[model samples]
Target: MKLAQRTALVTGAGSGIGRAIALCFAREGAAVAVNDIRRDRAEAVAQEIRALGRETLTLPADVSDSVEVRAIFEQLTAQWQRLDILVNNAGIVELEPSRQQRLIQAHMERLAGSGAPAPLAISQSITDMEWRRTLAVHLDGTFYCTREALKLMEAQRYGKIINMASVAGLTGLAGAAAYSAAKAGIIGLTKAIAREAIHCGVYVNAIAPGFIDTPMLAEMDAEMKRLIALQAPIGRFGTPEEVAAVALHLASDDSSYTVGQVLSPNGGFYM
Candidate 1:
């Protein structure tokens, strides 16, 4: 009940890390608003929160769309009157499956010293659409939601904003140029907002988790996944629940003195 009486909104709450964070907050006594671009998924998570005996709201909107984002805040404000926590966790890996598979295969071959001498050309392979969509969802979505959440939190002089970044943002992934760029942008955004939001008693921070056992990585073939897991000293992928624990800390008073920091749960992958 560390979060008793607090209200939280978790974007992308339908699945993976976002879903874990929403449920974690609910278990700790926060009334949670679940947001997912997929309305059905949003409703599903909201139902779970209701079962937890905590208040719940379902927000179905594309965070990349400013208009949709604004409407989401309006509905939240109308229903809850105030918000204490916001998790900017909506994101996507927009690379085509075929392209992603090829890239992964190429990387493996390269590691074995058997691939083509040329680079993967991943940056050159990115279409304008892929680059824009990646940034729109990861970077722009964070900005729009943060702006709206600030409106309510600023008035109350207290809030917690947890932005989801990635290990790719810190040590760029070889073939995920767009995702790496977008996450790096989010890290920059978190830092900038933290400096400003702290003035109003709002704590802003980021969680850059390592490869987690989520649907995102479920797309990878078993061999690729195995190799990635071994990249971490822990010799395994992280769990969404594990990442949610960090989110819980940031959203509660436990992190009162923590601000503008990127707390990574990468199992020594980067450090």
Candidate 2:
């Protein structure tokens, strides 16, 4: 019951890491807000939380949209009057290099045929749209939620914000330029907010996960899976529960003195 009587909002709670965090928070005695773009999935998580005798709110919205974000917060504010914790864990990944390239090329070709002048060829390094969307969902979404949540947190002079980053943010991957750049931005933003919030009794921190056996990792090929397993010092991918445990620690009083730190549950991949 580390989070007893607290209220928490978690984005991307439909499945994977986000769902795990939502469930963990609820089990620890928090009134959980489970948000996801898919209505059914979000409600499913909410239903499970209720079955556990925890108060829950199911909010379905795209975090990238400002209007929906504002509405979600308004509902939360009206219900709880205060938000104790905010976990920005919603994310998407693009893993297939060849298919990604082809998709980008086809999109450009379509736009060109539609009479919109075609831009330059898509760069193998990173396409403009990919960079934009990555930043929008990861970096921009974090900023939007943190900014909105801080207003309420500041009033109470007590709050915790846990952002989900990744090892790719710390170490670049060949085909993950956009994702890596966005996550790197999150690390920088987390530090900046932590400094400002410390004076007001708020803590802002991030978690950089590596090769978690979530749905995202399941999309990888056998070769990629073998490579990741071989690379990890523990010789296995981490589980969503393992990463969620660290998030729970950060969100609770146990991490009262910890701020602006990126906790990596990466199984010694980088170290």
Candidate 3:
């Protein structure tokens, strides 16, 4: 009941880490706003929260869409007039092949004779579009939601913002150029905001998770899993509940003095 009587908004709460955090908040007596792009998934989480006798609101919207983000915030404001916590956890990843540069060069040559848009490929490094889109969802979404939440928090002089980053933010991960950059941006942004919000009684922080047993991990092949497990000193993937534990601490008064810090839940991966 650490979050009793609090109001929290958790983006991407339909599944994985986001869903786990939303449920944890609800179980601890917080009224939660569960948001996700998928209406069915969001509703399902909300229903589960309600079943636990906790207050819940299911808001379906794409975090990248400013219009939808505004509408969702407005609805929350109308209902509670204030927010105690905001968690930005929605993200996407694109794995470009290592030989992308050579492939792009070949494609460009083949398209030279055709009067069509160049058959561009994401460079061996990564494509601008991929980077932009990744940043839009992870960094931009965090910015938009935090911006809106701050308005309410500033007035009350109280709030907590827990951004979801990744170990990729701290260290480069092969083939995850866009995701790595976007998450790194989140960590930097969290620190800046935390410094600014200190005087106003608001704390901003981020959690950098390592390999977790989420839906995303489920999608990985056995070899990928083996490689990831080997990377973690613990030799196994972490769980959503483990990450949720740190999130709960940051969202509550227990972490009042902790600001502008990126707490890593990784199992000795970056240490």
Candidate 4:
């Protein structure tokens, strides 16, 4: 019960990594606030915690929407008054390797042949909706949620913020440009926040997981799955529980001395 009597808000807690983190924290005795864009999913997770004899609050809101993110915090304040931990873990990944490669190659060719301004023509092959949507869900959501969390944390002079980055961010995954870019932004945000809040006892950090056996990896074919597992020197993909363990450490007082660190549990994939 490392988190006994603590209060935490985990976004996207309806499924996958977020769900695992929520359950793990609840087992460790944290009164968790389970958040998901879906009301039903949020309620389900909240119920699971209650069954464990832990207090819980279900927050159903799209974190990508700034308005909803603010309201979620307001609701949390009414229940707990203060927050001890926050895990910004909501994200989406689209598996379109060929499409991603096409965009990247086209972008590179244009940059080389036309001396084009990089920012003006970034990934023309990718649609505006796809790019914006991915960033909105991951990067924008993190910023909005963190902005709100910082208010409560800075005032109290103690808080833990754990962001969900991916190995794609550390070493761009060929088929996941948008996801990789968004996660990379999260890593940068964590470092900046850690530095800014260093004197306030608000520790910010990120976890970069590699090929975890979660819903994100469910759609891959057997061959693709095999390749993914073998990509890691450990000869297997990781588990959500394994990733949750790292969250426990970062969200606890044990990480008081750590700041803006991006912890990678990649099974020796990237070194």
Off by over 4 Å in 2: 97-125
Cα lDDT tens digits, model 3, 142-194, are 99998989998988999999999999999967557678888999999999999
Model 1 misplacement above 4 A: 95-116
**lDDT preference between candidates 1 and 4, better one:** 1
The residue-by-residue lDDT of candidate 4 on 1-271, one tens digit each, is 7999899999999988898999999999999999999899899989999998999999999999999999999999998999999999998877665554455555556758865433423345568888999999999999999999999999999899999999989999765678889999999999999999878988999999998888776766565677668779999998999999999999988787889999999999888
lDDT of 1 at 224: 66
For each candidate, give its TM-score against the true structure.
Answer: 0.96, 0.90, 0.89, 0.90
Say which candidate scores most in lDDT: 1
Query: Candidate 2's residue-wise lDDT over 1-271, tens digit each?
Result: 8999999999999999999999999999999999898899899999999998999999998898888999999999998899999999988887765644544555557857866544433346566777788889999899989999999998899999999999989997546778888899999999999999989999999999988998876667665677668788999999999999999999999998898999999999986
**Candidate 4 TM-score over all chains jointly:** 0.90
Report per-prediction Cα RMSD to one decimal: 1.5, 7.4, 7.0, 5.3
Q: Assess the local accuracy of residue 173 in candidate 4 as a C-alpha lDDT between 0 and 100.
A: 75
The per-model lDDT (C-alpha) reads 0.93, 0.88, 0.87, 0.89
Superposed by TM-score, candidate 4 places the C-alpha of residue 259 at a distance from the truth, in angstroms, of 0.6
Q: Between which residue pairs do clashes occur in model 1?
A: none
State residue 265's C-alpha deviation in candidate 1, in Å: 0.4
Candidate 2: lDDT over CA atoms? 0.88
